[model samples]
Target: MDDSKEAESQLNEKLYETRMKFANLWESCNPVRFKQKYGESLKITRDRCIEIYEEEKQMCDKVEITKKNIAEQNALIKKMQEDLQIANQKFESNNKQKQEMLKKIKQLKEELAKKQELISTQKQENKAKLKELNTSAEMFKKRMGLEIRRVHGEQLQFIFKCINSKNPEQLFTFLLRFNEEGNYEVMSCDPPLECMPLLQEKLKETNNLSAFLANVRKAFAALV
Candidate 1:
C-alpha cells in the first residue's frame, strides 16, 4: 500500500507540470492577445488604404478637369479657324475688285492719250489751211486789181476799177458774205446789172472767185 501511494503522488506531479506547460503555450497563442498586440498595425494599414483611395479619387477629378479644358480649347481653335477662313475670303474678293479697278484706269488712260493725239493732229491741219488761205488772198489782191474792205464780222466788200480799157470810167463793187453753212455768196452789186442773176447762179454752182471776176469784166466791156 505504501509503494502505490508514492507512485500515485509522482504521477500527480508530472501531470501538474504538463498542465502548466499547456497553459503557458495557450496564453502565448490566445486570439484576444494576438488581436491586442497587432491592433495598431492593422489600423495603420487601413489608414494607408484610405489615403490611397483619396489620392486616386483626386487624380480622377484632375483628369476630368483636364479633359474638359481640352475640349474647350478645341472648340476655340475651331472657331478661330473658321474666322480665318472668312477673313481670307474677304481679302480675295477685295483683291479682285482692286485689280479690276486698276484695269479700268489703264483703259481710261489709253483712251485719253488717243484723244489728245487726234486733237494735236487736227490743230496742225487747221494751221496749214489758214496759211494757204492767206496766200490765196494775197495773190487775188495783186492780180485782180481788187480792193477789199471788211463790211462786218461776216461780210467783205470788193471794188474793182476798170483801167487801161475802153470802159476806164466804170467801177464794179460787190458785197461778199458767208452763209450760215460757211459758204461764200455775193450779196449785192452796185450796178444792178441784168447779168447779175446769171452771175450769181454761176457763182453758186462753181464757187470760183477767179471765174466770176473775169466774167464780170467781160460783161462790163460788152456794156461799154
Candidate 2:
C-alpha cells in the first residue's frame, strides 16, 4: 500500500510542472496580434497617397490649354499691324502726285498772259507808221505846183519829173489853169512842152480826158 501512494504523488507533481510551462508560452505569443494590426494601417496610408497624385495631374493639363489660347491671339495682332503700315505708304504717294499736277497748270497760265501782252504792243506801233505816211504825201503835192510856174522855159522839164513821182491823188488836185481871150487854157506860160508826157499818162490811166482836165482846174487857176 505505501508504494502505491508514492507513485501517485510523483505523477501529480509532473502534471503541475507541465501546466506552468504552457502558461508562460501563451503569454509571450499574445504580442504577435498587435504586429498584424499595424500592417493593415500601412495599406490604408498607401491608398491616400495615390489619390493626391491624380489631382496634381489634372491641374497640369489645364495650364497647357491656357497657354495655347494666348499664342493664337498674338499671331492675329501681328498681321493687323503689317497691313496698316502698307496702307499709309500708298496714301502719301498719291498726295505727292496731286501737288505736282497743280504746279504745272499754274506755269502754263502765266506763259499765255505774256504772249497776249506782246501782241497788243506790236499793233499800236503799226498804227503810228501809217499816219506819218499820209502827212508826207500832202507836202510833196504842194511843192510840185509852185515850182512849175516859177521856173519858166526849158526849166519846166524838172517839174515833169516831180509830177511822175507824186501820188495820183496829189497830181490831179494841184495842177494850174488860166483863161486867155475868154477861152480856158493850161500849161502855156510854163513852156508846156515838158508837161505833155505826164498829162498823156493821166489820160491813158483814166480813159476820160475831158473829165480829168475839168477836175484839175476846178480847185485853183494859176498862170503857167
Candidate 3:
C-alpha cells in the first residue's frame, strides 16, 4: 500500500510540471507581446502615408505645369487669329482698290473706242467728199475752153455743197456771203479771220484731218 502511494505522488509531480509549462505558453499571448509586434506595423503605415503624399504633390505640380502650357498655347492662338484678321482686312482693301482701278480703266477704254468710231465715220465722209471734188475737177477740165465762168461757178457751188454736208449752214452761209461780197469779211462772218489763228495753232499740233474734223464737229455743236 505504501508503494501505491509512492506512484501517485510521482504522477502528481509530473502534472504540476505540465501545468506550469501551459501557464508560461498562455502568458506569451498577452497585450505586452501583441503591442511589441504591432508597433512595427504602425511605423510601416506612416511611411506609406508619406510616400502617397509625395506622389500626390508631384501630380498636382504636373497639373499646374500643364495648365500654364495650355494658357500659353491659347494666347499664341489668339495672337495668330488677330494677325490673320488684320491681313484679311488689308487684302480686302487692296482688292477694292484694284477693282476701282479696273472700273476706271474700263471707262477710259470705252471713251477711246467712241473716239475711234467717230474718227472712222469722219474718214468715210471725207473720202466721199474728196471723190466728189475730183469728179468736179475732171468735169471742169473737160469744159475748160467753153463757158469758163459758168464752170467755175459750178465748181464753187460744188465746194459749197461739200462743206455744207459737214458744217451745214455755218460754212455754206460764209461761202455764199463771200461770193456776194467778193472778199472775205474779217469780223462779221461766222468763221471769221479770228478763227484762222486758232486753226493754224491746232494744225501745228496735229496736221491730220481727224483733228480738223474734231474741231469742225465741236464748232458745229457749239453753233447748235
Pairs that collide, model 2: 189-224, 190-224
TM-score of each: 0.45, 0.29, 0.43
For candidate 1, what is the TM-score?
0.45
Candidate 3 residue 106 C-alpha distance from true site, Å: 2.3
Residue-level lDDT tens digits of model 2 in 141-200: 364342223234211211222333334233332233322221122344233344545554
lDDT of 1 by residue, 106-157 (tens): 9999999987886666556544533443454576568756666767764667
lDDT (Cα) of model 3: 0.56
- For TM-score, the strongest prediction is 1
Report per-prediction Cα RMSD to one decimal.
Answer: 12.0, 23.1, 13.9
Of 2 and 3, the candidate ahead on TM-score is 3
